[model samples]
Target: MGERISNSRVVISGMGVVAPNGIGLSDFEKALRNGISGIEFIPRLAALNFGCQVGGIPPITQEHIDACFSPLQLRNFNSDGIIYGMIAAHEAWRNAGLEPEAESLDPDTGVIFGTGTSGIEKLNESIKLVDAQKVRRLGSNVVIQTMASGVSAFIAGHIAAGNQVSTNSSACTTGTEALLMGYRHIKAGYAKRMLVGATCEHGPYLWGGFDAMRVTNYRHNDKPEQASRPLSETAGGLVPGAGAGAFVLESLEAALERGAPIIAEVLGGQINSGGQRGGGTLTAPNPEAVKSCIKDSLVMSGIEGAQIDLINGHLTATVKDPDEVAAWAAALGRDKSNFPYLQATKSLVGHCLSGSGAVELVATTLQLQRGFVHPSINSEDLHPQIAKWVPREKIPQQAIDVQLDRAIKASFGFGDVNACVVLRRYNS
Candidate 1:
């Protein structure tokens, strides 16, 4: 880690997001500012007799699909995660002023896009064909579509990435972990620029396991918009969602030389796990580990916890919301009276699972760039335990204007894994 201090500084040059609340950066920012809810009822889930019939699926139309994929490339393309990841990656590449159709491979640019369970829908289709003795009908695209690295592989080809192109999976921590991985790659001089993000597919096939675990909200089937209630007293289980968020990370020197639009500076980050010990389980995070991860992130960033203007927390509208708040407060050594402003993107977009961390990071970057804190909608009634650690004003219910200099984003996932990143508004 000490070597990173002397290496090149990493900064975000461009960003693209396909969140349930919004598709592109402009619409995402608008949706966040306006506190629009993207969770809605799905007829397919209802027809499937799912306990939770509503979800946060991005409203991707045929036009959106056509813009990113050619007719030939779209053949037998059933992986929603790959489509979302490619769309976001292409947008990020173009946003950074790079041509995706470049004939030559970019040795200096790579990809670290990730997904939790890629192409579950495609896998299901292939299974049915194989069971029915129609193996030949599975087609040549099945392997690419159903592979866990499909998202990264597709984007790497689209951009002609000749560097380290790979995918990582750590349950819900996948996105934030991918961002940190890219940051380290540039800091270590492994690549000059890297496209980093995560994507996840939605629908019963992928979400059924969570529903069976009884971790998904089943009470809000009638009122979809109010389903995800992070930090609220009436909060239920999480509402499953899917989407992708991507960013182009390059060295500060490279970005300046190329005249790229610097979105935010990646100060530093930390990734660790609780080892499922000391009260941590496969499904729950250890409080002490979460606090240590946050504290270490600030140390790596060379900033005190007091410098954090806001905390984009991984509050997934479950019993863990209060615990997460307590962890943040403890890590920063701040009380409710002086705690930094906290925002929960999941309140509006639900839990995007593997894609949640990256999508939330995009929202964090937009707030830092545009000077505002989007409201944590559906949290009008703060959780009692959380209210004891965070003041009501610290959790704004509506958008507020503020010149944010720095922010910290943290994601906690299953398997007791955690990832935290410190970001600053680009100064130069």
Candidate 2:
């Protein structure tokens, strides 16, 4: 951990998202405001006799694909993660008023897109071909599609970025970490702009492992929309989801000079791990580390815990939800009477794994910019333990209007990794 640079400020100028509930910014904002649930029944899961048949998948159409990919580039392109990443990245680049067809490379622009499993579907295809002694039948794009950094490489070319281009994977923390990495790159005077985000593929190949572990919700297959019940007592487990989210992060000065649309300010953030010690494990977070991560983030942002008006939490619908709430209460030194407005994006889009942090950050940014907190749907039956720390009204079931200034978004991944970022409403 290092001190935040004193001279530089980072801001999010533009954002793009491909979420289970919605495809673009306008639709996504409406979905969040309306408490729309993107979790639905996937027939393939049922056919495979999996314990959880419901999942969240973006409703992407052929037109959406055509808009992002040229016909030649789509040849044998079976990586859904790459497709979602490219769409979100392209939209973000254009949304930031950056030229995609520029003749010269952008020496000051970089990319840090990430994914947990880049192309399981393509890998599975290639495996079968090799096993059948038909290796020659494999397509030319196999390596690029299967590699972890494929998304970043694709975006680098699409935007003609000549600066640093790389991928990062930290279980579910990948997206939030990507944003912070970009922020640090600019703060250190390495780049003028960075396109950062993460994506996850939707399919049984990637979700089957969770189902086999019995960590996915199997009780709500009949009630797909209610499957992801974050903060609810009736919650069983997470409903797996997939999609991508992206942001164009620029220095405050550069954004102002270009007259770009500033969505929010990236004040500062903290990223750390529990080292799977002190009761932390491959699947659970260490309480102390979680608190320290939140506290350190506030310290870096130069704000007290009470200054945060909202908390976009990584409250996946599971037994750990109450623990996360308790950690926040301890870290902020706030009780039920004055805890900040808390909402769970997973309640609307399910647990998107590596993509969860980025997608939720987009939701958080929208709430801060628009002055409203979206409801934590399906949490009507709040858990008893969580109820002790947060008032019922504070966990809103419907969108509420409020003038928000400072908000925090935190993500805790499977490997006991945690990331917290403070964001403020942009003010001239």
Candidate 3:
């Protein structure tokens, strides 16, 4: 069992994001504060057979399209994954200040990224072409392009990282799943460094599928930004958006030796599945599973709930999700008044699915770096029932006043795959 892989420290040395808020850490933060929703009005896709006129990453302009990727490169690749992975991974490597040609790191550096709803968009496009009698027009690259792991492979090539690379497709929990795997690799000494996170690209096919589930917002199509109201009374459902977030993980020792700027220490991460899989609604979460994961994660970190200063919740704009999660917190005997502060990043960036945890992870790191907490913009009135369980009124917006040092980010995937990660402020 390779010595059971025990007792090692992991740290988050760097991170990068490609959100609807656009690229660059500074610009992204501005959007977060100003509450600028990236969802826009696209005239072309608007006329398509769809129910909602909504927001999403706008169409790629010709100059940007041509400058970033070529027809040959994307010939067999999913355009959504290709665009997101390239931008996110590139920014992550640059942010780490790891010279592309650095010789200090080992060749065994690993990569494990989470991708939710991969290639569905491209698959839909190809199927449409077939229906239109454009048989010969179909490109030969369809098979490779639609592969879920295609983005991971493309990203590995860019870094010239000839090492172990893997991909996770665990719906919403995928990003945190990838990070957990990387943490294990470093702790087990299998790899000294790794790049992990998640990404998503919005497309008509994805939206249509969600619509079929009758879980998406149809009433607020005209007001795209208002479509997602996590803890609000009029909340209907999640407004699917697209973006990518990546993190560079390195052993604490390795990072200090290189003198790189460390963002936060990833103390421990744990995952748990719900009991009697079929008992819970396939698309929903379970309180037992949430409580189990939280308890187990704290045990792994060897910290009490009282030690954590913040709780970054997976508060997707839904009627039941917030209640389910708050119930779990209450079940653990966590006094709503004193346990930990709570904030939901989905309230800011919208839900990025695979990239949600990754983006929140970065957001938490920024909180630790700047000593400020981000508020769930526009959530003035939290649900009354949930307020009893979630003590904090709303995610704080002003500069952080307290000496907050540690936080937890929790994510729940579609199949009740609950993942919780703990982070500590870097004291250096």
Q: After superposition on all CA atoms, what RMSD does each candidate show versus the true structure?
A: 2.1, 2.4, 3.3
Please give the distance, in angstroms, between residue 21's alpha carbon in candidate 2 and its true position after superposition. Answer: 0.5
The global Cα lDDT (0 to 1) of model 1 is 0.92
Q: Candidate 3: which stretches are off by over 4 Å? A: 1-6, 41-46, 58-78, 101-106, 128-140, 275-279, 391-394, 397-403
Candidate 2 lDDT, tens digit per residue, 174-290?
Answer: 999999999999889788889999999989999999999898999999999999999999999999999999999998878988899898999999999999999899999998999
- Candidate 1 similarity to native, TM-score: 0.98
Q: What tens-digit string does per-residue lDDT give for candidate 3 at 1-428?
A: 12232455788887877777666567676666566666554454467845555645723444534434557875555567557766777778778877444445346567888787567867877899999999787688776567778778766766656557878888788888788889988888877788888888777766667766766666676776666667765667776667787888988777887887788888887987774364445677777778778878888888887788888888887877666656556534576666566776766566777777777777777777667776665466667666666665435544344556888888888887889888898876
Model 1, runs deviating above 4 Å: 1-6
lDDT of 2: 0.92
Q: What stretches of model 2 exceed 4 Å from their correct place?
A: 1-6
Superposition error at 336 for model 3 (Å) = 3.6
Clash counts per candidate, in order, are 0, 0, 2
Whole-model Cα lDDT of every candidate shown, in order: 0.92, 0.92, 0.72
Q: Is candidate 2 or candidate 3 better by TM-score?
A: 2
Q: Against the true structure, what is each candidate's TM-score?
A: 0.98, 0.98, 0.89
